[model samples]
Each structure stands twice: as structure tokens, then as C-alpha cells.
Target: MARAGLTAKYRPQTFGEIIGQDFIKKILSRASQQDSPASAYLFSGTRGVGKTTTARIMAKAINCLNGPGLEPCNQCSSCQQITRGVFPDVMEIDGASHTGVDNVRRLREDAVYVPMSGRYKVIIIDEAHMLSTAAFNALLKTLEEPPRHCVFIMATTAPEKFPATVVSRCQHYVFKMVGLEELTAHLQQVLEKEGLEYDSEAVRLVAARGAGSVRDSMSILGQVMALGGDRLDSGSVREVLGLAGHEVYSAFFQSILDRDLVEIHKGISLVLEQGLDIGFFLQEFASCWRNLFLISQCGQAAREILDLPLEEFEFWLEMSGKMPAPRIHAGWQMVIEEQKNILRSHEPSLSLELLFFNLAYLPDLLPVEQVQIKSSESKKTSVQAGRAEKKSPAPARKLKDQPKKTSGPENRESVPAKDLDWAGFIEFCRKSPDADESLIRMLGNCTGRKQDQTLVLICGQDFIFDSIQKNGRRKIISRLAEEYFGPGLRVEFVSNGSKSNSAFRDEAMNHPVVQKIIKDFDARVLEIKKVQDRPGFPGNE
Candidate 1:
């Protein structure tokens, strides 16, 4: 009943003693009773979910001084030595510090020696993904044919980074985050043993904050109780933790569903004033959306979706119906994107605000029925047409045409395409809004091939150049021609070009870098800007 640490007070003594991890307990229990135990094991999961704790328990179970059984008797020397982590044979090394080949070479030299006090020497390595390539190669050799009196236990939070060879040679066990109910029940036992009184809601709040780690839950309880006096209330938990209130999150979400940016902005400002980490706030919002989506999809039984208190679960169940599936799914994606931006951006608040306004304009982007209007000018002409039902009452006679504004062919001047400035032409193309980085590259590579007075664009690659035109690049070309030349002229492209453009400029203008450059200059590129006359000047609008 007395101990120096809290983990020691609750550390499981046997397979059956471990709570919230019954599945892992069963596998280890059977292996302790088997004729041959595996040489190496890989435990992959989030931290504080009993990976290292279970490894110590399994080591004691196999090497107990008494009879070898599924559970180790703590009275035995093997159990006591392992429980305190003082055993010479069972060494626990931190992979983060000892990841070099030289350190692993020393391990290889010691691995050959026989166990002095136990049946087999067990090595538990934490954070195995941090191991160097050479260290992994050395371990891979040992895993191929392990020593007769040796066993290896590797634990990591990121198994995807581990080498395939090291993973292939070991039996892997993935540890899941403990559920809410199990964590709450376990915390209740802890509170009662410590002689502290807590309501079910208070217990649930501590469990939820633990975020799936029992160790963290106990740590949180210790922090809450350190305030003194034993009356644990919901307000006290909320005040001490300073988390964004559940109602705040719920209300912000309702505002999003209703497309009310004003309500959402007010809620965001309130949370920011509390000095909360914006990244964590975004993560919490995403998590809340995820739970609501699950509740909406799963109906009543969704109560078991996570470890919320009954009151909190009821709140989500009631609120889930107001949000539609498409909206929820899009919100989930937007939240994830916003979280990423929060990490990479310097202005987290501005990013969060932009993310909310972006949600208001979603239905516009979704595909809908297509309406055809030939052009802006053509749309204007159609609008000017009179009512059709009132016309054509008598014989269908045609009206006389009006006089033409210009005698075009006599006065028109040809550019001749021979003296065209390649650099100047590319600068004009850069002004086109329809031209993205790739299309700009294509234009830069064009050669001025003229058939008499006509300028034909000769692009080096057919496939790359054609993507712009087939994908409706005419807006860009028309804009370019109007700016650099005049109306009634067109640009045509051919597959191969006779010259090359500098790749350096193209490489520098990739979309992300271009955005940074625009921000740095605080100026729009000339090509994308409209050329208009001054209001008071002659020939001006």
C-alpha cells in the first residue's frame, strides 16, 4: 500500500492484473506457457499504453525462479528484480541515446555471454525507430539467429520508420489507446484508494483529458488534487485545465452549419483570449467533429464511440442531427487542412479565421448543372435582345445592316513576327491570368515561326503545351493578345520549338515560391492587372 511513485502503486503484477489491455495480456500469457517463445517482439502504439510495463511483466513471467507459469509470483526474486528494473540480465536501454553502430557493436559483444541469474537475458529497447542504419543491420543479424539464452523486446511509437528487415525478423504487437470507460473506471478506483471524492462527470473529465494514457490520467488527478480540499467539481476541472468549453466547440460547429461566420468568429476570439495553443485548438475541433460524425452515422449505439461522460455523450447525440453528412465530411477535411496551416504559418489566428470564411463558400465549388454562355460580350448581346413573343407579327422581313466602324484591312498593320522580342513576349505572357506556372513555361519555350505575317507558336513538347489549350486556356491567350497586340489576332502553337528558355526562372516561379514572392513584394504582377484609363482623363471611363 506504500510506494515512492504512483506508477509503482498501480503497476500490474500479473497478466490478469493489467487493466484496459486484456487483448495484449492474452497473447503474452499463452506465449509464457508455450514450448518455444519468439526471439524478438515489436510493440507499436502511442505512449503510456502499457508497452514497456507489459514487457517487464512478460520478462518476469518467463524467468521466475519458481515454476514457469502464465503469471509470475512477486515473492520470487525474478519478479522483484524486474519490477524495480534492477535486474542485471534484463536491461532496458533508451534507443534514442544509444543508436550508433559502436554502441550496438558493444551490445553484440555482450549478447553472446550466458545469463548469470536468469534463464534468458531480455533486452527492452524503447524508441527503436531512432536507431541508426548500421545499428539496425547489426540487430538484423542477431535477430536472424538469436542466442540460446537471449530475448529482445523493441517498443516504438512509429513503426513505419523502422527498417523492413528488422520488422520482418520480429513478432509485432500493436498497442491501442485505452478507451474512455476503461480509463474512467480505472481512475475511479485510483480516486477511491486515495480517499478523494469525485462525481461521475468529474471522473469523466479527467479521463477525457488523459487522451488515452492512464499514466497521464493519474498525473492529471494529482495536479487537480494538489489545489487542496477534496470537493472535485466540474467548474474546478474546467477552470484549472483552461480547455475550450465543450459548449463553445458545439456552438461554433452549429454556426458553421448555419453559415454564420459572425458567431464562429466570436467563439474563436473567446478561445484565443484564454491563451490556448491554436494548433491544439484546431486538433480539438477536428476531434469534436469526428465524434459528431460518428454519432450521427452510428445513431444511439454511438455512445460507445469514445470515453465521454454520459452527459457529454448526450450533448453530442442531440447536436449531431443538425449537421448534414456532406457538411460534416467537408468540415473534417477543412479542419485537418487548417491544423496543418497552423503548424506551418506564423499567423495562426488569421489562418483560423480564413478557414471559417472558406467554409461559407463551399456549395459554389461543388459540381452543378452547367450553363453555356459563349463569352462576356455574347452574354451582354443576349441580355439586350427584346421580348421574342412580341416580334414577327407580319411577314418575316430582314432589317438593313448598320455601317461598319473601321476599314480594317487597308489600315491594319501586321507585326510580321520576325522582329518579336522573345523576352518581352514572355513578360506579356506572364501577365495572363489563365497561365499557371506550367503554361508560362510552355510559352517561354516557343519560337517565333512566321508564315508570311502570321506568328505561329512552336512549343518544344506537344503533350505539355496541349494541356493548357484543351483545359480552356483561351482566356489567358486572349488577354495576352489584347494587352500586347490588339483584338482580332490569335496565337497558335506547334509541337516543337527551335530554342530553349532559361530553366532557372521557371524553377523559381513554382506556385508556392511565387506566393511567397508576391507577399514579399506586396505588388501584383503586371500581366494579371487590368489596363484602364484614368477617370478624369480623355477617352477614360
Candidate 2:
């Protein structure tokens, strides 16, 4: 009298009708055709990947009166009985309801009987993972020594819950989730069969929302069709499913690009008011950032990866030009890392608001490349100013005694001792093949000063000071310092909060590179320390 739901009405009757899992279908079909079916089969996968459906088909294929064949001939009375779930030889048990040992004992007792009219008696257990441990133990003996005329098919979403003993007695077949393209094509075919007019994007949205579950997609499509009538569009799908549309994401990205906190707040308020699914919204937001990043980096070639509609691809491509790659990359990272926190927070809406505000202000902190460029530009300006201020050429005075050479290869040129400072040392370290990039980056946070013949490096953090003081790192620093400032020049590290004058701290903070680092990292000077050279250190001695 009433039409069946799409999932039941269009359920696959044969292996060829199933949408995915080509390999498993081939193996099972061959086994059925050859009449060598396993005594027990364990089908496991996520819901709606057709585990239970496949089990029913296997029963029909085995019991078909025509012959033991690769596919069930639905024309036969045995196949029709199994299809209608009225077959006397086929028993479908719900594992959730029959979880006790007593139920399992009854099943074992009944399994001993031979088929009344078919070649074998088929017992299908759905949600087998829900069975109790005792029940599994009870079923173990029957599964291990099943009757020659009986077949046991157990389907479960979570196979991990089954005992190893029970699993070892059966042939396990793992079902894979349906791919996005396959799922979309299936939904389109279903709509065509129903004679419903639908947009391609609407069908895709339903499939994406299903997330590899055919039953879930069918259910969603049914609901959308009920409200959407015969015509299904992307707008109706988004409205019915409580999903934000492309325009919402586009406006949000524009707010981020314009650095407008007010517009961002408005966009968030609209999303909350629309009652959009927060988890799915975050997922889509992350996808948008990913698309922007790819488009920014790969340009037109990104279309191949994105696989979006021409209009949508062009929109993102234009937006990508407005945002820098580094900013897009940073935004992508922030959204991905904060998704869990936002969903877990007591006030998810508030957490989401904070996230958008953070993205809006991301430009205030310049990217690493921009910071390095500004630092280099300042250094060049300072060098040019010094050159312009020089009145005459200074005479080079010959040294009475040549500096002692350190042991190394003949081609290794000695570093000049004049004008050796922290900035110059950092530049030299960048060029040196022996210097570790991590150590060089760590040294970027330190300020240096000359205390007579010793160079004292001031660290704002205790961890940095401790890290530089390790024997291996200490030796490397000492060797580099010796090469730069000449041999026998002692180097000492002072941690934060050490005694130092305000004048020295002020000068250190004002240094070009230090100023750039402070701006880029949003760091403040905790305390500047002046180190007193010790007399008994390795180089000091």
C-alpha cells in the first residue's frame, strides 16, 4: 500500500548490483558457484556498506533450486522465499536480542538439523559484536565443527569485539567504505529511478553528508525529497540538512582578508542563528582553507586537485589572489588544530568566535619570510648610512704579530677578527656548513655583548640557556666563536633575571634584529643579564 524507503526499495539483489567491494564480491560469487562456501563467514564493516545484504544474497545463491550458481535466480521458489524472509531453511537472528548463552545454545541445537528443501540451512547473525562473551564461547564449538549441511553468516560493525577463538574458526571478509564518486553516482541513479529532478550538487551534498554510509545517504535523500518535492537543489539540501552554503564560507574568508572583526562576528552570528551543525561546519571550514592554500600555491593547476565546479573554482582562485600563501597556510593550521577544542568546549559558539577573531588578527604578526626581509632591508640601510658618513679612507696598519691559526684543512680561510658581533656571527653561521639550523634559530633569540676579551650571550629563556650550555652545543659555539673572534676568546651564557643595567637592556632591545624578532614573535624582554667571566672555564684558562 505504501512505497518503501529508498534504501530497502533499491537494495542490491545480486553481486553485480552492489556499488563497491569488487574483489570481495568476485571471491564470494566464485565460492558460491563452485559449491565450496565456507562453513562460517564473518562479515565486518561500518554500517550500510552492505554486509547484512550480502549475507542474504549468499543464502539465496546457496539455496537456489535451479542450481548452485554465481548468482541467485530469484524466479525459483527457494530464492523467492529467502528474498521475502520467509524461507524455512534460512534463519535471521538479531545478535543484540540473542546475546545470552541460552540463546546461543538454542541456536547450536537448531543448527544440527538438515535443510528441509534446500542443499544447506543458512543462519545469519546481524550485529554479532553485540553478543556476550559467554554467548561467543557457547557458539564457538558449533562454528568450529559446523554441520556439513549448515552455513553460519555473522555480520558485525566492530569485529574487534569478537574473541580471537571465535574469529579463528570463520572466514573473515572485511567490507570497505564506498568511495565518494561511487556513492554520488549511485545516488544519481536512485534519483533517476524515482523520476525526481535533482541538481548534481544536491546529490553530491547528500552523498558527502552520508560519509560512506549508503543507508544514511538514502535516508537523507528521502528527507530532502519529502521537503524539496520532485525538484531537489543545493539550496534545499543545505536548508534541510542545516549546512552552510558556499556564500557563507566566501563571506567569512572575505572578512578574514579584510581583517574585519565586526563582519566576522556577524558571519558567526548568522551561522549560529541558522542552527548549522557545528562539527560539519568546522569540517567544511577546514576544507575551504585547504582549497585556498592549494589554489594560492598551485594557481590554475589546483583545479585538478580541487575538482570543483568552474564557477566555484574561479571564485576561490580569485580569493586566493587576495590572500597571501603564508597567511592561508597559517589560517589552515589554526583551524585544523582548534577544531577539537571548539567542539569539546562548554560554549562551542564562543570558542568558534574566538577562532575567527584570531584569524582576522593573524596579519598583525608578520610571516617568517616577511620578518627576515625587513631585517635584511634595515641592515642594508644602516650599512649605507655608515658608508655615507665616512669622510676618508682609513689606513691599514700591519700587525706586529700574526694571529695564531687553528688546525683545519688548508683551503679553510680564517675568519677576520674585526667587527665581530652577534648579527655578524649569525650571518656567518647561516653560511657555515657545520652550523645546525635549529641552533642558529635558537641563537636568534639571544643578544650578545663584549665583556673585555669575552663575549657574553644573554638568553631570555632558561631552556635556551640550558640547551646552549650542553657539552656538544657548547663546543660548537666555542669553536665558531674562536674562528670568528680569534682563538682564546671566552664565550659565556647568562640566563634570564640575571643582574644587568637598564641602559644595557634598552640598547639590546633596540637592536635591529632584536626589534624584528620581538615584533614577529610578539615577545617582550623579561630581563637582560650581564655575565661575569669566570677564570677556570675551558677557554678562559
Candidate 3:
């Protein structure tokens, strides 16, 4: 006896045997049982959804000697011949191989002959979209008005490729993908009938990997059975499918929620050791966060929305409850951003590691409500400390009695602004024996005043303050002040918001390089922020 594959051995022979296509089954059954069937039929759907199978079953149903009915009697010679592909009255043609006009012309000529053995001659054309335009044109008249004893059935994954005239002449039925639950149940039944020891998780995984195709699921099951022997488990299925275990995702997500950088690093290392594709891992990680987001919102209601098994849904629900929605949402966004970068990167593993580190610190960055609450609490603490300082009189009195002078500089009000000329100081800096041009240009936007021993220079722009705050620039300014004024004169730079700052920012934005960046990225300059003395600006003092 010849060994038949699972897909062939389990091929549906009757409408009742076909799973997950009740509409197609119902339509075909009604037509097959009728006294007068449609002369032409069109079946359209994705691969492995039983378009060709339904067409063959219809052929058998029509030709079966028992009766022209919905069910075919395999015991009948006509049905057996059709099943074995040797029926004289039934012809199964491959549209791809016979795409020429001459091939269709021969088919047209053959259509004229009456059924030799069966009541009706059935012609099933698979992949009908592959038929050439000339061939379809040649068969139009014959297809529209075939002999009384002939029935034509055409199946195609892409029906739109068929000419409008061809489609209009036939009764069309559209097939849909099988649902996950339906596929899983069918796979479980198949395994049980085969007397294989299989876990439910293994069947579920195979069903998911099939992506709503029973034939595809069966094909995967064959490979899994070959590798897993008689007993099947979720771990073996995961290994075969190159899928990360649920625990890996849980650990990675927990690290992100705790903002544990070390744990995140270890988790990434473990993932690499598993030899998982970084891009696929990141995609799955993003999906996990999305599932968490859904669970956190709807609770138990998320089970239906997620379409996952009960235990998997419960796992996600428990993880989601530990973190707030906004935190998960933020992590989801980071994973999304890094996924794009990872695709374009040459070193995906390194990119993935960096992404993990970035996600670990996401809570500390911005937009997380916890960080905002902490900031508000710190402000309250500062206010309370100020009130406490006010309640103590001894510290205030001691400070009042102490001298207000310091060795560096003094903050005295009894001074004139004109006494310390900023322009003259810049000119002096320019003529100095060891002068710096950048330092001199920065001093142009500043005005100074003599406050006791200190020369207080107020800068119009934050950039000017940054330039002067640098160690080299500050030493140069102090040296110039001492040389131009007195030996004890000290220089102090302060940033004060001014209209000139906006003008400078606009001028910088209009520069050629910045304009090119804006044009290339379609970007806009939002604002020119003032640089604070303590934190300052990036890439500056």
C-alpha cells in the first residue's frame, strides 16, 4: 500500500467533512442537490481554504450514481473514479499549464461532447486567474453557453484577475480564513484520532503558526510529529518554531517596570544566548506590551479581545495589573521606536541591547505620572524647608551681623554701570597679547556694572553666558578685567533673557545647514530655550 500524506489522506470528501467554511458548504450543498445546477461557478479565496476541495466535492456529488444530491456515495463507481482522478466525464485542468488560446480552444471543442458515463460532465479548473486574456476571450462564448450535460467550476485565489465578463457569467462564492479556535479544535481532533499524545498548548501553537489555514496547520503538524515522536509538548513546539518562552517575556517586562538596568541587561544576554532574531524578539516584546495595555484596561474582558487561551490571558492580566497603563504605553512606544532603528542597523543585537537599556530608564525620563508626582513632592519639601528657616531668628541675625564682603567679589548697589564699559573691555581683550577671537565675540553681547570689587557682566543671550562660563573663556575675561581695570577687579557673567536672544536664534535657524536639515526632515524649529547656569545646555558649558 502507498503511504498517503496527512493533507491528502485527510482531504475532505463531503461537505460535512469540510471545517470552518459553513457558508461555502451550504451554498455548494444546495446547488448540488438541485435538479438543474448553474452552468458555471467561481470560487475565490486565499490558499488552503478549500476552494479546489469544494469544487471536487461538487463534481463527485453531481456525478454520484446514487442520486444528484448534496452527499456523494464513495461506494459508487463514479464517485470513486472522480476521487482517484480517472473519471472520463470529469476533467481537472491546471489553468497555469494550459494558459494559451489553443489549449482553451481544445477544451471548448471537448465541451461539445455529451457525458460518456455520468449524467453530467464536470470540468474543474484550478488557479483560473492564471488563464491568459486571449484564452479567456476564446472560452467566453463556450463558458457562457456550455452543453446541457456539462458543468464548469473555476477556483482562484485572486478573482480580480479574471475578466469582468468572465466573472459576470458565473455564480461566485468567496471563502474566508478559518478562525484560530476552529483551527485549534480541528488540530486537536486530528491528533487524537491519530492516537498521538499531544498537549493542548502544542496544538494551539501549531494553529497560531498556521495563520488560519487548515492545510497549513496540518503541514506544520506533520513536521512537529516527525520531530517530537509520539508525545508533543509546548516546549518542544516552541523549540521547533523558534519561539521564546512566556517566562522570557515576563522577565524582560518585569525588568522594564522595575527600571532595573542590571536585570534588563541580563535578560537581553539570555535572549541572545537563545539565538533569537532580535527584530522578531522586539516585535514580540511590543506585542506583549500591547496585550498588557489591553488587559489593564478591560481586565477579564480582554480575553475575548486578545483571542488568547484562558491561561495565557490570565498571565498577561496579572502582569498588567502590576504596572499602570501609562507606563506600559510608554514602554510600548520605546519598543516601537527601537524596532525601526533595529531594522536599519547592521548590528541588530547591539541595537537590541541598547533598546533594552533605554526601556529600563523610560520611567525616569518623562511623561510617567510617578515622576511628575515625585517632582511635586520635592517642590513641597523645598517650601517646607524655607518655612522652617524663617522660623529660626538666630541664624538670620548672625547672618545680618556678618560682613557681606567676600574675597572673590562683592554684590554692592553703590556703583555706576558706565564705570565698567563692556565695549572697552572687549576692545582690550582683542588687543591683548594672548587674545581669543571667540571670547571677544561673546563679550560683544554683554554689558557690565561695577558692584564694589566685582564686575557684573549681564549677557543678552544664553549662548553668551555659556561661552563666558567655560574655564578658558572665564579666565580670559577675568584676566582682561584685571588688566583693563584694577588688579583686584573680578568678572562675573549672568544670563538675562533679552530680545536679542530670539533674534540670534532666528538667525541661526536660517543658516544654510539648519535650513537643509529642515527641508530634508520637513521639520520646524519650536523654540529657543534659555540655558540655566547649573544644568546649562547640551554640547555647551
Number of the top-ranking candidate, with lDDT as the measure:
2
**Alpha-carbon TM-score of each model against the true structure:** 0.62, 0.68, 0.63
Candidate 3 lDDT, 1-541, residue by residue in tens? 1122778888899999888789778877887788477899999988998898988899889888997787888889999999999999999999999999999988888889999999898888999999999999998998788898889999999998999999999999988998989899988887887888888878888897787888888888887877847688998887776778788988887777677888888887777787766665676788888998878666787777786767778788777656644456667877887788887989877888887886765433311111111355674674465445542111111111112333455433332323335445565677887665445544544556666668777764554575456436678778878766556887777776454455556655665545654565475542343322423222124
For 1-541, candidate 1 gives per-residue lDDT tens digits of: 4322556687677888776678788888888866256899999989888888888888898888874777788888878988888988998999999999998888877789999888888998999889999899988889889897888999999999999999999999899999888988998888788887888877787888888987788777777777667777777776676666678787876786677988978877987898765665677788887887777666677776576767778888776655444455566777886688676888877888888776654433311101114556653554344223222111111112211234565332444333234444565565656556445544543444333324455543443355445446656765665445445546666554222334533433343434443565363331111112224211223
TM-score for candidate 2, residues paired by index: 0.68
Give the lowest summed-lDDT range of ten residues in model 1: 390-399
**lDDT score, candidate 2:** 0.79
Better of 1 and 3 by lDDT: 3
Worst 10 residues of 3 by lDDT: 392-401
Model 3: residue 419 alpha-carbon error in angstroms: 42
Query: For candidate 2, lDDT tens digit of each residue in 387-497?
Result: 454321111122222334446552235554443556667777768887765467556656666655687767645656765764377888878877776667798887754
Clashes of 1: 2
